[model samples]
Target: MCTACLIENVKSHMLSRRSLFSGAAATAAMGVAAGALSARPVLAQAKGRVVDLTHAYDSDFPTFDGKPGILYEVDKNFDPDGYHLFKLTIFEHTGTHIDAPLHFAEGGTSVDALPVENLIAPLCIVDISARAAEDPNAVVEPADIEAWVSANGEIPAGACVAMNSGWTARIGNPAWRNLPDGTLAFPGFSKAATDLLAQTGAASIGVDTLSLDPGNSPDFAVHYSWLPSGRFGIEGLANLEQLPASGATIFIGAPKHRGGTGGPARILAMH
Candidate 1:
């Protein structure tokens, strides 16, 4: 422990510390670079106008069942608490919502368990509005998918194939949910069309209507087949008309409640 010996030891310790810190800093910088690369596509997509595809619904929003989908009770008043809030009693399948596989299958993924990658996807809007305008029960048939592919290129893998039935325009009207005879009538996906979507490796199906199948449908064929097969569906989507037939990407902000069969979602579209 002479002075020179001690000084040399201290110098060695300082050099080791510098090396460690340099290595740590390099690792951190590499992590940031990787993160930026992964985020590029989403950030680039945001350059265009973002369209909200969700419908802001309330207790009165139309549902597959004719009951109220949500109920509200004031929990706090602004004058008294300096804030206002309402306790919400919400039904999972109400509003612009997602239908998880568990909605039908015996053993399936719940809303909280839906894959993160599947939630954001390329959007393919099949415009069946002309047919829907003529027939309330008109469905997006297999032919429509064919036409979509004819006009656009292939439906991207893991894309969300949505049926734009012009039905969102009817939301405020009784006809949106039912016909004059009290029978449910609205446009949706035919089983054959969904089968086509599945063949194309699509991840999800969507409808501007209340159900995946036509309102007058007696059998939930699409629901039974599609959900059990591991794909999900979105119902009550809005602003579908604002999107193009292809190229737009949809971001589904699904609810992550445990064991949720489905739940209200904030869906958006970006080019």
Candidate 2:
């Protein structure tokens, strides 16, 4: 099925569940009005706690293949111009960002075309940090997804699966890229794992590393396997260690660039 169809199916299922809950609430309210039960105490709504999952972009931020990182210039300063204004020159894919399907898939959805619902969804973290520590080239495999399912049920449809390989801890260091041998060596998703997640109806797959595919991959098979389905990718994420394996909802605030293959984003997780 096309990406639009997959998203529509997910929306349909969510609406049905919401309707069921709304109906039950309405019945309870009626019972209360009729005095069938004692008056219940009104509970206050809980405030959501949000965690930043994006890295702050700066000149020091790492980039792939020695690409220019970030450039900031003061166009106007308060002392001289009565306004503190600046111009930022940044690559769309710099720092923490969203990789629209068009980044890898020809004729796929651009960053601006992604639906709002798809930008916010249940967050799932698959941690391969221990393994990554042992081998910088370790990849998250299909068996890892199966293990996650075995322990915590199936991943919900339209969820964003983030691979936490603990690489975020090395963000500013040379280890983030690991190019000693002229090949990047950080951990990422294998093609099998990407295929499994796509099959499970994942809306997006993310990583704390620079790319969703491992550093040494020349074909970027994992990106091809997922993005062509109209899904997205998030990379260079920070603070994955602060989030739980499940239950958090992610809000991806990506720049709306028309015809953009990808763009920077402010990713947040609310629990």
Instruction: Please provide, for model 1 over 1-271, each residue's C-alpha lDDT reduced to its tens digit, 9 standing for 90 to 100.
Output: 9999999999999999999999999999999989878655444445477899999988888877789999999999999999999999998999999999999998899999999988988888999999889999999889999999999989888889999999878878988899988899998899999988899999999999999999888999999999999999999999899887877889999999999999999999888
User: Candidate 1 regions off by >4 Å?
Assistant: 1-47
Q: Candidate 1 has what TM-score?
A: 0.86
Please give the clash total of every predicted structure, in order: 0, 0
Question: Residue-wise lDDT of candidate 2 within 1-271, one digit each (tens)?
Answer: 9999999999999999999999999998998876532211111111377889999888778787667777989999999799898898988888999999999998999999987777877888999999999888789999999988888778888889999999988977888987676678888999989888988988998999988998888899988878888999999999999987877888899789799988889999887
For candidate 2, give the lDDT.
Answer: 0.86
For candidate 2, the C-alpha RMSD (Å) to the true structure equals 14.2
